[model samples]
Target: MGNITETKVYMLDTNVFRYKSNPRAHKSYKKATKRFWRNVLQEFRNGESVLYIPKEVIRELEVQSYTLSEKENQRIAQLLELIEETVPDLATPEIEHQIRKITAYVRSEYKSDINAARDMEYGSVSDARILLAAWQYDCIFVTANIKDFMLYPLLFPQNESRLFDLLSENYVIIDPTVYENIHRDPVFAGMLQDLHNMLER
Candidate 1:
């Protein structure tokens, strides 16, 4: 296993996959973002990183299939096949244990609709179970659905930290924009350039 310093294992949200294949969300997305998808996958191929996804996430995505062309669906299929190589097969024994315990706790403690907001925000039963699993695994919650989980940091004030801290609290919910700005950010780009220069010299 690689040290935490080098490889940041990220739990990808469903929308990242969706945004790539389905052109329905953004009117101009297909024409607009040719390079964006390329860069994200490049990071995956190069980073020596683990792309962890809860089985639930994949199941949900698979079930919620959108209308797309034969070519687009075929592309998504091929992409998933490649991604499967890098995605760590998590959500195994520990996830099963956590889900049982967490479900019991939530059903016993929270039955009212008042906390339903939080429940639904976290995607109710499965999500609560998944978050607990994320905590156990010590991975960042990489998601385009930031709004779905932003309440996490707010609800648990102690979980707050900067973007760089991947394993701070329960999970670090990285927005898709974080990947978008990877090489474009002046600070990080300059640092990368300096590192490159040092390595070359």
Candidate 2:
């Protein structure tokens, strides 16, 4: 609470990963997230914190990472494989159950004896699933999905979205705006270069 440094776990999303490849998204936020990522590596080097990727997040980002850089593409592949070995899959029964339970609860909370949700307005099931992962991991859902995640709540009056605050408290979900805080540290400098050099060999 007082010190931001207390946040030890980070659950990233595809949108956050895509920022490295998509300059347009980075430009919108003034390239803050890009810089933060470099910083994240630096912190990781410095042992500031631990980075844990939900299996699904890794799968989701791989498709995009390949388009960005030969190194990034390859790196994503390696990460995914490692994650597969560890968690093996993203959509497990527990995750699905969590998604379903959250959906049902949210639906009930949104229940009005007035009207039903329109197909277009209700959005997709994927939204709930992503939210579920963030909740379950007790980590932030780091995403650049401004239009969908951030702005959508404004459209609904009783929309009940502590989505950002809720996650920030439990999970520290950094948007492009907050990434610099996540990554900037005295820690990540030569560690990554050493890793790169080792990998090259």
Candidate 3:
């Protein structure tokens, strides 16, 4: 057999885990969702890729878990255990500085979109912190909340320009929907294949 290939590192968002915990919630695309997660977990199991979850994302999941039904809470507990075994949690003192920088940038650039008085609220900083963690680790930031993250590249044009210059690079953001459609659509498969190929290099 040929040598085993190294794959990209994926820094997962909270929504990705939420969907993994309850793929049936997306009944219309249940099969596709299941296949997507199966492929992702297989990559991890095969040692092709490393998975990371920011500490902030874990905190969010823990908070959300408390509101779930007993069965769901048990399910989440098991999932968290699996994640603890398979994925490394990203945490550092410098993360706070990055979060502050991101918050300042967002507040300044999107001032009209946010309530200035409430800009410093707790919930407002989580996403920024997540993105900063992904950026810091140079991982592929995977999420279901695409629109929210799409703003990052636009907000920081210099980074976008740098990313374009690097033919095979990291810090790209992707949506799990790409995986959800992989079996039914050639386009989705092609997109994932391309990412896989790039990461392997």
Candidate 4:
């Protein structure tokens, strides 16, 4: 984690809103996720940081919520209440242009691999917008699906170098299913440390 300390803006992905208990996950992992969100709420309440969810992510969550279990739906509803700031509107022409360019790049790059192309095409537009929004707004993009966002830089480093650098220095990746892979974002690391300390207590 970087030593940089200042008020921060965090751009959250849709998956971060999920707190559904998974049967296969260890109990501690679920507890950690809950603690993570609790810390988020604390930060929000204290106005120490800004948490932003793109409008696209919110819409995606609403669509997915329809198929989720009642317990999970309730958790999502509670999580939604933590949105203290307005959702960032990602529908501008500039954003649309970036999304199209990214889509074209993904398609052209993965032309030889049909399955890869399909996967890229599936959610690339939305993912691209989210990634771009994080970059555009200079916000730390937090998500459980690190690989998905990391794929852009790994594939096309030339255009996404700035974004790559930002993510490297400030982002947070929280894999809800496991305790080990949660990484980066100094603020979040501190929060995770506090959670660990509480568990020890």
- Model 3 per-residue lDDT at 176: 38
lDDT (10s digit) by residue, model 3, range 124-154:
4677577656765666666655434543443
- Candidate 2 lDDT score at position 84: 14
In model 1, the number of clashes is 0
Question: Model 2 residue 54 lDDT?
Answer: 55
Write down the worst ten-residue block by lDDT for model 4: 173-182
lDDT of each: 0.47, 0.42, 0.52, 0.53
Cα deviation of 12 in candidate 2 (Å)? 0.5
Candidate achieving higher TM-score, 1 or 2: 1
**Candidate 1 TM-score, C-alpha based:** 0.50
Per-residue lDDT of model 1, residues 1-201, tens digit only: 756546655665555566667757574444333343464467668875556666666666667666557666776676566553233333444443434443343334332322333332334455544554354455556544443343233222243431121112223433344333333546444543443343344
* Local distance difference test, candidate 2: 0.42
Off by over 4 Å in 4: 1-5, 20-32, 91-123, 151-201
Can you write out model 2's per-residue Cα lDDT over 32-106, one digit (the tens) per residue? 565556666677666664555555665566555545767666645543442212222434444444344433433
Question: lDDT (0-100) at residue 149 of candidate 3?
Answer: 56
Per residue, candidate 4 scores C-alpha lDDT tens digits across 3-25 of 65566677777766663333334
TM-score for each of the candidates: 0.50, 0.47, 0.55, 0.55
Q: Order the candidates by lDDT, highest first.
A: 4, 3, 1, 2
How many pairs of residues collide in each model? 0, 3, 0, 0
